[model samples]
Target: MLSNGHAHWTGDDPKQVYAICVASLAPVVVDHPQSLVVGKGDPATLLCAAQGNPHPAITWLRDGTPVSTSQDDPHSHRMLLPDGSLFILATRMNKKESDAGTYTCLASNTHGSARSTSATITIATLHSQFVVVPVNVSVTSGQHAEMSCVPPRGNPPPTLSWLRNGHTITPNNRVLVRQDGTLIISEVLQTDEGEYVCVATNPAGIRRSAPAILDVIVAPFWVKAPRDVAGVVGGRAELKCRVGGEPPPTVTWRRAGGQVPVGRARVVKGRGLLLEPLTPQDAGVYLCTAANTAATITANATITVLSPPRMVDMPGDVEVEEGQRLFLRCTVEGLPPPLVYWAKEGSQAVLPAGITTTEQVYLSHSEVAKAGAVGGTKAQYEVATAGRSDSGHYVCGGINSAGGVMARVTVHVRPTLPLPPPIIAVPPTNQTLPVGVAATLRCLVESAAGVGVGHQPAVRVSWTHNGHPLTNSPRHHIRADGTLTIKG
Candidate 1:
């Protein structure tokens, strides 16, 4: 080998000779250090990887020591990987108070060395505690019930739950729990009567409080409801109801939203609503209510007050010839309907205004309907064949639970003609028609052929329009069919 900058190769030590342009390397740590906080008895990981032209080596240390620096640790807890990273180089599993401290990660290469910023690792202790106690709940049946539980916060907030009768039921239509740990029952029922317990749970453990008893008393109820009743005037009426509950319930009665008038004859309170000697005003709706310490129930009924009968459309005395048929018609309106009859006047006959009819003949019973509809009941007496002996004083009577009504009509027997009122076989009503349309009007007659002994005269039907006779015209015609027609 030449000494002066001139290369003269000598091969005695060939391994000592090398050729290179140039190589420089320096490790640079990751720009940031991570501070770690994990639960005690848990594992923690730290990273200190570096970058350089040549791959850097990773090393973890505690308080600048290559030896174990963890307090009271028996052995090293680190595991280094081939890629220059480790699970725990100076750390241990199941970390304790002594394991919580500043740690450093160092990386090195042929060019230079680098180190990470101090990382503070902390091991947190977690626990849960009882904060509030749920007490025994006593709520009346059919009332709102509310219960709650409170627990001290943990590392994480604990989950809360409520249970009944040792079984956990979720919040539903009947029961619900709020985020604030309140269990609410909108309407407490018999099924809600049981013991309750509050349960608290966290990662640390679970705790259940002592059972809190829930008592739900039975609510008052109506066993027998008041039914609608119809009572006669000057009669007695009564209403009753049966109530049962855990505690004796109070019962009261009212009429038409007001108190039933109290009197010796009308005792309207208590269960028995006695309307002795009821009047027309005593009829109305009534309410009966039952109440107890738990709840209340009500029952109601209608009271229909009835009145006496009254006669309508009475005829005056009549004169008819022998061998004539007579038609006796009478109508009466009253409450509770009535039974009508015809009585023959005798030497000792007398009439009273109550429900009493003596020495009478059965005629026909009438249909019951609203008095305001058509007429009331219709009672008709017809004599198909008659003689001089048929004439007499005839009394028509109607009787019901309220009272009686009667009317008398007298007749004379002679060879005289007695005009009879015309009864319509066809009734007429209004109608609408186009100007060019044809229309008809009909009128039929009832026969009174045997009404008198004399030869009867022919009957005639006349037409009237605005008080003037409607005569034959180009648009109007009368036919034998008793119809009036108009030509279109």
Candidate 2:
């Protein structure tokens, strides 16, 4: 007999008959194809292996479609090897017919058929040119600098790096390479100036950007600063300032808190600021500024205009009655602000005895005093509740290194006079009334003013009934203006 294309003989005698039997089994994959990545125009291979009762036949499929092997078409680039592997002579990069996709192998025999796990095929490529490139840039020393780059499209996205004058730049605290492929220098120095190039690299190839030039400029600095100057009124003054920088800087002059004097002030080309016939208003802080493309610098100097101390507001004579307040005012103006003091006549010592003198008389420097005109210091001497003994000749004096000034103020304290007594101008008249009727009386008194310069004398009125002083009661009402009323 014959079964499954194999011969088997059986007979009555066991020693005369011979039989051969073989078992059938479905195919099982032992090795599946592996994923692979290859450059365009490069060779690739996908491997598969299986075991079964009958020797299995192997075939390949790409993206769920059967692949054409060299046996089916001799001109095809893909071939099936005897060892159940797929070989490609050359990979194609065409958009529609590319040799890159998912692939799998099928193994079959008379018993059954088996399929293998999918494997992926990838093609790597990199463009030749960059999308964005670095360019020339100019910045001052100690300023920020940046260069941007966008690498070409590539498989596995390219990495970016920077090269300065053909040498790789290592990232440090000041130099950094950002995630977006930008090179940044936090504070650029003079040595950082050079030609820069951007490099892009990937599995396929490396691409370099065009060279970019970086220029570092020097900022303006002071070579010689102006010095403090002292000038008398109607005298000339000059101030000089010198500067240095890579690019020539421009020099200008200005008053710190005010504008430079327009007519009297002049700027010399190589020299500095010049002022002819200076005035008292020219005394202030002056600034010399030097500016360039890189930065701006400034220096200041004080201009002091000297003038002697003179009285702007003079104190005059004052008179007051006993127990009255008195004040004397004196204001003086001078350069450096003269110190002010008050003293009584025939005394060289400062007034109020033993206390230090200041710009404000008898008041602490921080105390608020009466405001005087601009450039003038005001001094006031106050006497609270004066008496006859307080009368004297007071002098207000101001002194500074420039000169000294003095002004006298006479003060008189007159004695207070006594107030005259009140006299009865109209006497009360007699009134007679019957029972349950009211009686009215009228009284008027007058008083004379005091002889001194003070308040007037006050008069008070009262009534006596039968030698007894009358007061307010339910029956008797006293008005505020000294009027009396009786209720019946």
Candidate 3:
């Protein structure tokens, strides 16, 4: 083609034609000038030029696929240059590992076709680093334990998941995953103790770490009476021990000297020991033990007994008022139970208060008070009257299997008071008066001597006639005991 708008050809001669034929017979050659550069998910282009007769047409193939620019679509396009160069818009498909392969630029003309060496464009896939998250784990009953998941290395960042006992443990109140990729188990129960795994996955591959096992141990507790005890004659005492372990515990009892058990003693077992009817011979060291495998623990209990109190005898001679209530009590303290009794003093083989009698016997002041008795610890007597019959001495006695004792009290009652003498009236006389009614004044007394108030006359009377004194000497009337007197 020429600018003349018409086909213009020269050198039609044999030599000229021969030269043109030779040149047309030569094969087309294509060359790519620039190396393609592109990032993931971006476009790139490879330049290719071809020289040949009739202006060689150029075509491009990527990964064996033909490149056609005639469509005018961004995803697939091409441009034919005046110099027979080929330009194609290689839109980046999803960047992926599979997008790497050979790309060839093919140029062809009427003479022949030629291809440029492959300009391979590799699209790298987005990748993340891999990390192995380490789990920091511990377990206890009703407590929280922490675990972690991490990868070796990654750019897009890997996802972390935790597993326990081969099962995926979800994030919850009981199980939690921290921002730092740590797994946490809240309220770690006995069942929570187990093996755990950490798994990390990415576009490249998936990885898992070694399983971690956690064992939880629980401590034991005390549950029984003391194991040891000691006691002497006439003393108070008790026995105790302890039993402790996980899943509770069981308790049992045994003799220290390995002797067969006998009566007068009772035993209870189950995290503790029980004793009944303790006595002087029963006093000694005792042992209590508890065991449990779940808690992997055991414990022991020890008890000691001491001496008994000495016994004291009751006193003699106890006095009380006629109608007053009375009571007598015996005092004793010891490891073993003690018996008590009461009786009258100076009585033949005295009865034990209620012994051989139907009424209940009182051993202490409280017991006596409950019996409607008017006395406390000491005996009391009610005052009926002041009479010789109301005075006497009484006694309270106490007796027990260990010993006997007694106490004494005295009581007194007094008599009531009597009336006083009568008043006297007299008439004055020149001289001494004759017998009775011969102008004489006198007083009559009825009280006994030492029987009036303060042992003195409660009433007195005086005689007067016209405010004049009577005869100095007059026969005097007096009652027996001299407590009463009269003028005649």
Candidate 4:
């Protein structure tokens, strides 16, 4: 036989509970509280303490588990000596997880176990970031360019885009998108440079990286070489034009004043418009025009060619020994080839009989050879075995092809010979004598009359004292002894 049990129990004796609680109860307190603030890489401390009737034993636990001391693990935690307060020694904690938890302190003794409130332990990752951008980037007028966008960090990585004047950039044949969120542009024209923005996006939020300015640096076009040109009267010069740009700059040369013909100009490739054998007609400002990719540029330069060259050193009359070579040097300077003609005084230069003349030519020795020689330009001429008859004035006249005078020089030569000195006689023969003392000196021309000094007059007699010229006085006169005397 089975019987179901259903019974009603009465409350325990209230007096019996009061006697059990009185046997096991202790007061709890915190003497030194723990709170800390530290940098990401630095260490921190959490102090939890209490005082009781009986000395209490303290223990530290993180997230309800005991902290272990392991040097190998970077996220490990531990406590060393001085147990009452917990020491969270030197360590790194991941901010995302594993490091975010509560730490509790439990103090136990004979009175009973009294647990303190829990505290949190967090490991913050370091935050250090910056940005970079390009200042000035230039390309040719009709070339290509690329823009870039970069960021320090992002959760799902950043998506890069370009904005021009606050508007999104769409790709075309001229625009290209890169994996690193950079923009590649083809045929970057001069107008492309200005203000632009780099946009970076992620699920967290859309962040614009920085502002980048595009500067389409274009090379100069139709550029003239020199700023100014100066020349003398009746001379000629030229101006140069060089260009820079894409699609190859096409150069066209023009004169400033009017459409003057490019006369006597020899054009050489690359160097510039060359004007040889220049004249006054070639003086003026010149314009150079250049075109590239439907764009045009112009540059101007002034040029002035100088007139007939003035003789820095003039040619004049001169005398030389009869047997010596007579040099008739005449310097005539002028721009272009000046016609140089040599002639004698009072008559046109006539070649000596049996001596033939080379074709009339202009000579420029140091620099390039002149254009001459009847058929072509030859720059040399010479005459040899000169005689006394050859003594006369010679002329070098420079004339332009326009028959205008450029420069002229005249030279005159006289033949002579060195003379042997005249004989001399002296009454006294003693060698040394003081200056200003009376002395007799004599000279005679019995044998060497025709001999002269420096091929001039006669042997000269001079009196000098201390390297100074001394004049003849009544006391100091030429004596019959041919000696100069001073009466001292």
Candidate of highest lDDT: 2
lDDT minimum window of 10 residues, candidate 1? 366-375
Task: Name the top TM-score candidate.
Answer: 2
C-alpha positional error of residue 456 in candidate 1 after TM-score superposition, expressed in Å: 9.0
User: Per-residue CA lDDT of candidate 1, range 9-83, in tens?
Assistant: 567776655443334569888743588765554566766678886778777776676424232253556555455
Quantify all predictions' global Cα lDDT against the true fold: 0.67, 0.79, 0.48, 0.54
Where in model 2 is the C-alpha error above 4 Å?
1-25, 140-142, 154-156, 167-172, 189-193, 216-488
Residue pair clashes in candidate 1 = none
When summed lDDT is taken over every stretch of 10 residues in candidate 3, the lowest stretch is 373-382
TM-score of each: 0.33, 0.37, 0.23, 0.25
lDDT of 4 at 14: 52
> Compared with the true structure, what per-residue lDDT tens digits does model 2 show for residues 1-488?
77876666655666665556677879999999999878888899999999998989999899999999898999999999997999999988786688889999999999999999999888878898899999988788889999999999998688999999789999999999999899999888866877899999875677999999787667655545788998866787888887666788888888987899999999876648988888777777899998887778788998877655677778578899987887777877765567777888887777773332245332222111111213457777777678787799988888877779998888999878876676777777777778777666666666674232354435666777789999988888666445677777
Please identify which of the two predictions, 2 or 4, would achieve the higher TM-score against the true structure.
Answer: 2
Q: Write the per-residue lDDT of candidate 4 for residues 1-488, one digit (tens) a residue.
A: 11233233345755433211123335364744354434344566667676665667777677888655443345566553354666655545555434335767777778877777777655433212314443345576568787765644654465667777578888888887788667788998654655667776654345664566665444443323545666554344555666655556677777775764655654456536666665555666777677766577676777655554333233556554444555444444445545444455578654342333323334444221232212112222234445566565555444553343322333334455444555554333444668756565444433354444333554555666679876777676764334666675
Q: How far out, in Å, is residue 319 in model 1?
A: 2.7
Q: Please rank every candidate by TM-score, starting with the best.
A: 2, 1, 4, 3
For model 3 the local lDDT of residue 454 reads: 29
Using alpha carbons, what is the TM-score of model 2? 0.37
